[model samples]
Target: MTNQQDNIAALLQDMKSSVSEFEQTEDMGILQRIDADFQRFAQLVTLFLIAERDTYYGYFLMSMAFRTNYAVSTIAGIRLGEYPPVFETNPLILLKYSLKEILYIFCHEIDHVVFNHPAEMMKSNPEGNPELFELFNYAADASVNDMLNAEIKHGKKFMQAPKGVVTSKVIRNKFRLSHVQPLESYQYYFDLIKHHANMLGEPQQNGIAPIPSGSAENNASPNNNAIPGGVATSNAITAAGAAGNINDHAWTFATEHDEPASESAEAMAEAVKELLNEVDSMMDGEARGLMPARFSTAVARANKPPALNWKAILKKYVGTIAADKVKTRMRLNRRQPQRFDLSGTRESKTLKIVVAIDTSGSVSDKEIEQIFSEIFAIIARRSFELTVIECDEEIQRVYQLKSPKDLPNRVEGRGGTSFTPVIEYINKRRYFRDALLIYFTDGYGEASIPRPLTYRNLWVVLGNTSNLSVENPYGLALPLEE
Candidate 1:
């Protein structure tokens, strides 16, 4: 076996030996008892890590520090915000389950982290209403557990979910909710539950009532009676019953003592994001592919880049282009005002820009209109000797527009696309040699366009295509969103 595997096996054996030794001994000191509990908790975490190696959850578990917190009402809960995030659990409580069941609970808690429940709860319950926070926990748990249950049912995972865990199936059946869908956001479930609670006219202080032991709706397994957290009984759904307060979600909002958390909600959310990103980077392609689709979908949504402001980018690029200055003796120069005969000069600045429109079959009329609209807006903001060149395989039409009004009502050319023609057309003209070239196209043409050495060019690719996807040998490629 590999060194890491050998170490894990040795650790497992050591834990077993320690447990046997502790069981046989009758008396132990206070410190010894505490150490024993801590050791056992560490062993349980080690066991979980071994089972989930090379997986996202395994990476998360490796990164976290597991502590034994008997004060925590739940079997376990995670804390974020500070460096090296923590997972605290009641070791004595954890000892109640089989290895598979423990693994299930461990993954369940990780799912909460994966879904960013704590940060979300903080955002949704800013007022920190105890009742609303309770509701948020339920909704979050239902969403996560339903996903886990689905994965389990599909035989994609080996862990068996502990009995009486909060799931969408259980919540839907208990609340008579037929319209609720599976694997939805926690907010969806929260809204439905809150609305239903309000309609029932139940007092918020009393909390949602639990399922009675003898009720037909109480379909929980016989052995699965106790909820993960200490808030409710196995058969109840309220703060005093089964469904509410599954885990210590309040840690995201506050410390264990109910004091406010050290980090702001935004900071905590960012920390969770960074941690997830770190774990994501560590996962290989095969490991990522083995992950449930829900996880992949969530990761994609979380990591999606903010939309680019194409208009601002276009304006910025245009603003940086060099302007040609002309000197005329129409006005007095500030430097030499003493002699009237000494002809003072007036300065005039004009921007000469070439806008090449690809009138190929691939380029739509709407795209052309959008290109014109943006160009017209830019022209209105500044003085320019604007030259609009329409081209496909060759130059179709060229307009020297002095203003927006000078633009043609209709453009020509819808032949096959080739950037070579436009490059040649611009390079051959002495007047256009010094002007900045701006090409608007769908970027479906040849990748090996001839480089323009005379003047700088900018490729404003229209539609969803980005600069990286376009082929331009010289100058910047700016993507224009439609």
Candidate 2:
């Protein structure tokens, strides 16, 4: 036998042994039927590897935790963030497809992870709005399928995407958007869909109807109970029905009453970085070159450092604050070790920061959430006093936050925006004299305001930096990325 054939045979045998061991330990009556389905899946994977030997070996290597689960919501799906990552499949559903189509679906799930779609979708729809999440899911599937089809056109035609699969063409035709490029970022597609939905005056203001509970669109947990003959339960069948349009985007966000298996956007990005590094280390030059450029580009973009290092900037400014020092007799002075009378000095490290949020009509809910999330993360890492001043044209509320949990569920303001009130309020307070003032705004207010003389000013402008930079003659103006 050829070396590749031998390798495949060894893999198949290993998988059979693992399944047999599982069967011996478990009391499930349908283990025999599951074993049959797993054998078929192994055969399909073998055929897939033989047909597209050069293209997806790296992906298979990266995804070592492949399993056959009859209860998987979709025909096939990948759950990332775990080491080796889990690739689960409903073999019964996959058995309906041709080997070529099966291969296409397998790669489709891998591409979703390779493109960092789940984390991006989660970041975009932080509120976990089911309809918006579905929109992102559609967009992500389209982008992946478009890229896969483009590759097929370039002569790697071992696999063919099944009919009715979500693609860029389908999305464009559905939305009547003829101008969108064949391949665009997931965000591009999502934004385009949202804009189109808004223009059409669709329900929910953001477009797309709210997904009802237990609906096919709702990514709730599947009923794992198999019929007497090992047929999928109702919930699993419902998910399988929507396989053409949705490939288990449940990994992107948490479902009601269930803890998320997925990581946060920041954590997921780090996981992707590690995955990419591992893939690169495993693949030789020829294999690496055979991989699509889009995959590499996506990885680079996803792993790219933020344009502005907010943490470093905050540290640079906050680190400059002088702390109160007191003499202690615990140790000798560094200046003169021989002088026993002198004591070591200990400096108290306590930071006081006054944050002014511009809760004007122009600032969006998403933007406000972003600002607060960032601020919470920054403060969570240090011992600091946070005084939040919510303002629009005037100060609406003042909060002294002892912890992130102490933050209010809602804030006042949403009228006009003005920075003067916040500045004047801080300047007039004796306690805020030593605190650094950070004004988080959309840079839409008066042309200029009286700068604070008692404290340092850090103007964090959302979206555009030009307005804040041009208007504010003093203090540092930093751009807060959307």
Candidate 3:
């Protein structure tokens, strides 16, 4: 046999063995129907996809992950392929759903890949709990489903609302969060679910219990890696080992198998750029409309903080906070590297930084998550005496985080928006003096400057509004694109 054929044979063998948990099906009828429906489904979704995102070209490159294994449980999942660069799925299970539902599910899978759910979650938690991982999946689905439903309502004829499960809109509204991009939204929901899991224990672990909604970021586990909620809906009930493991964060499975010889994250990024180029000429206003500016902003966010890097901004303002040059005692310290000048040392100062987040009704969970991630990154680098004030119309909770682990699990507040409360607290108290005030907000509320501004402020606004409507000539107003 030729080398190519031999390679194909070997790959097929590897797949067969890895997924050899169940009997290979001989149901030709189901296979034929899957093939037939997928073609029509693809045709319809192609229009919606184009209408949705021109950068979402990765959808066309996916192949089926459906091995005839009973372990996959009828929960249709898309696995990122590697060896042959395809998406793997179980077609038999998908056949049971309606054409609209099938189309929605397929589109949802594409959204998963396009948004880089698996990679992002892995980045967030490499050894994330399996049960928690599944809940993250549901949160992601809810975020995307909310976006899709929004577009459908706006006039996307081909798409429809997803059938079941909690939605991002519901989560955001119930908590009084603002509209953040999808990536942030997913994280926000995950945090909520994580809180739910703590109160009720993992839904699956308990069999079933209604999740309670509470406000505040205090529910965080000690490790600070916990994500919220899992799908305990009856739909999630399946045969043993069918739903996959916790690391099955997205289409790319973990315990089962991820794409073999699959494209690396860097390679996939390059391929997406090429794909975007290929489709650039075909895009029209209609397609562009489907790809709303908000959604585009969201996809952009999953990469790195867009347009403005919150990291760089933080550095510019606070990077040089504490520095003390002094002579070191190298001879006494055996652990110091011999190549280093251990004799010379500088003492790092403890920076007392005040982070005031707008937890108003308008601020979204995704927005909260994004802001929290940035703040946590700062804390992760070094110890900061962080004073976090969660405020809506008024302050809801306050956290004194000495270490990154001490960071709270969620943000609480859904009242009307305002900056006065946090600013007033910062100014009225001498304790907050010399503290760098970083206000994370959407810049939509009553931002009338506090008379005789007592401290330097950084107003970081989230969402489409590029500039805060209210003028703050005293401090820098950094507008973040959603």
Candidate 4:
């Protein structure tokens, strides 16, 4: 047993050293920050699990990526089945926000993972009412805030894996959370969680006091801790004894709280919106008080169904996308409208084309048909034989299309989507000299494609391309107008 313990200890030390080495090698400190955040999450989950409250596992699955359709603090996407959790960082966001927000962002994702809340928040409510969706947003925001607050009260911070030891900021690490109004968007999300828990007969701690999302009114809350010189935890200890006993305390905490319902459908939802309002009020008062209400008030102004005008939104988002992303486009053959002029003139070059497609179940039948129509139109107009391949995970169908009618009745395989085989085929099958590969996807590719040869790759993303992070610095990403 002693030898086994020693081996485990040695392994952990080695792992930490390796991580430290990697952090140094990659100047991007985001990974180091992520590591810390993940550690905190593991610890929090451990407590919850010890208390026999495992429902919060959803938090780990949540992710916060930098480039998104919305400028909102974070966005989440869902997939079916249990998979290891992932966290993706947006380089642009890291440069803008404080390191604290990054930790907050990490916590937000961890909250999703801990709660194991599926990405149902993004889906339209069963009633299909936009108001319900808004309400749901509020509830989620509230829940998230509540969890963060609860974690803080417990003296939790991002630590290392397995043994979550505090390595960085305390709950008092005030980023937007401290100054921003309480029950603001994400804070509201946390609040909603607590509220829903209460509605289901859970405990509610008073005196922690709630503040308006944007209001500076009554900033003197007794519970608000000021780090390094702030409120000290009465029970917080640096020793392993404290850490080891966390599970026991968690179990005790569970006994003190009310029993959670197996389900609290409507009430849970209502809690979400109120929370959303609280959060949004802090960030953009007009958007929350005005835009949302306006969107709800009379007839829906943009009620065309939340369709994507990619050309329009992309144009707006392009200005905000990092310079590195723009430079990535420069390396690819596809072109966006130039913001500046290059002093030297260059001659136009002709390129071959390859079209890879994801024929997955999440893709609507009509969407697939429309995508085919568009591709055929583009191919018919252009003077090239479209090298078309259909895939879910592996290359299921391959066609050298001379005419649009050559398209198959159905691209087989309804399994998981993978982009590797088609990418390998394109890079290796040298039939098309200087090919421009336009991939049509619902943005659900599993294996990522490497940077293609000389601007030849074009992700003609069909659905929400925001769901996928094509990490290639030279990848061309253009989403279709849904």
RMSD, each candidate, Å?
12.1, 11.5, 15.3, 23.7
Q: What local lDDT does model 2 show for residue 370?
A: 65
Best by lDDT: 2
Worst 10 residues of 3 by lDDT: 206-215
Number of colliding residue pairs in model 1: 5
lDDT of 4 by residue, 1-482 (tens): 23433443344344334333433353224333434443444343334322322222222222211211111112222212112222332221221222233344445544442333322442323444433333344445345555465555555443112111111121112111243234333333433332332232211111011111322321222231221221112212111111111111010001234433322222333333333333333333333343323223212322224344433342343233222121232343334345344232333322245667777766565766676676555444344555777788788878777665666766677788877777677667655435556677767655446555523456767545676645562455766765
Off by over 4 Å in 2: 1-58, 195-247, 252-263, 306-432, 438-482
- Candidates in order have lDDT scores of 0.62, 0.65, 0.51, 0.39
Worst 10 residues of 2 by lDDT: 203-212
| Candidate 3 regions with alpha-carbon error over 4 angstroms | 1-71, 77-85, 169-184, 199-248, 251-286, 298-482
TM per candidate:
0.48, 0.57, 0.42, 0.29
Q: Report the number of clashing residue pairs per model.
A: 5, 0, 30, 50
Q: TM-score: which candidate is best? A: 2
What is the TM-score of candidate 3?
0.42
lDDT of 2 at 361: 70
Query: Per-residue lDDT for 1-482 in model 3, tens only?
Result: 33433443344333333222212333323333434444444444444444345434323432322232222433444444343333334433333334445455556666665566655555454555665666666577667777667656766544444344346654554345576344346777777665443432333310111111221221221121221222112222233223333222343433344533233443444443343333333456565455546545544544453365455677666775544334676433346656465564656465668888888766676666666667777656665677889998899988786655555666798777877788787778776665678877777776476742434567777764454665653676666652
* Least accurate 10 contiguous residues by lDDT in model 4: 245-254
